[model samples]
Target: MPITTEKEQLVAELSDKLTRTKGAVLTTYSGLSVAQDTKLRRKLREAEVEYRVVKNTLTRIAAAKANITGLDKHLEGTTAIAISYTDPVAPAKVLSEFVKELKGKNLEIKAGIVEGKVIDANGVKSLASLPSREVLLAQLLAGMQSPIVGLVNVLHGTTRNLVCALEAIRKQKESA
Candidate 1:
């Protein structure tokens, strides 16, 4: 079958998005009101995630073009993709929080891809449970500094004790 220019454009655009995204969450947004959808979009936008309803077939083509596999099964249903280029956890975290806020009313998470690896819904939730990248990095830095800080304190204490002993000897000699 000859491909239409419009479809080719769509495929190209989606392929580019898929290729560039660090993470993407597939969701079923059926039965959501316009207000709810807008709110969701706004939240996702603030998190620097792109949320858009996607045609399943076109997305499948795009996924193939982007060399992403294992996305076909989750592509069914009322599909919208939340993609983030900067933070792999942003989409999952934002979507999970939004669904929790809605009390799981209209939006249902299907699956997700992180760093090019396809993960299940539970995996997506686990990813969302993690702290943000900055927080994790901070924690790691603190962890790395802990031993050094302890060592410095130990050295300082030893030097202080030696100085105190020397002062006591000097005082004894003067008294004698």
Candidate 2:
């Protein structure tokens, strides 16, 4: 039998989200209480992440359609996926922080797909260890600006030297 229209629609929506996502972290929310869940959702939302509890079967189909492989193994159990469309590291950071706050409760990161690469839980944590996207971009811009600043200073030094030489020559001529 074919899948129902609603199911197909859900899969399509998930697949589209997966396609547009910069990164996604899949975790099992087994023992989470309502309050903790709400707090976690709020944190993720503040970071602009989309968190969804997905049916593993439909999610598996959607992941494959989105060209994300190696996730099927991690799709088992009570799976929730956190998708970050803008900053690739936001979901990982938020999820890791929540896990730490919970003292490593039933919230377990199974796997992640970042920039089209599937990684394990350790990899996800490592990603979280990185600075935020804005910080990284600022660092890059500063690094790139350094050379330009150095060149401008070098040009100014040459002009300064020429002006000093001219001034010295004028002083000598006036004395004569």
Give the best candidate by lDDT. 1
Report the Cα RMSD per candidate. 1.2, 1.5
Q: What's the TM-score of each model vs. the native?
A: 0.95, 0.93
Question: Whole-model Cα lDDT per candidate?
Answer: 0.95, 0.94
Give lDDT tens digits, candidate 1, residues 39-148. 99999999999999999999999999998999999988899999999999999999999999999999999999988888999999999999999999999999999999
Clashing pairs in 2: none
Q: Which regions of candidate 1 fall more than 4 Å away from where they truly are?
A: none
Q: How many clashes does each candidate structure show, in the order listed?
A: 0, 0
- Report the error of model 2 at residue 97, Å: 0.5
Per-residue lDDT, model 2, residue 25, is 96
Cα-lDDT of candidate 1: 0.95
Q: Tens digits of per-residue lDDT for model 2 on 1-176?
A: 47799999999999999999899999999999999999999999999999989999999899899998898999899999999988889999999999999999979999988987899999999999998778899999999999999999999999999999999999999999
Model 2 has a clash total of 0
Residue 17 of model 2, lDDT score: 93
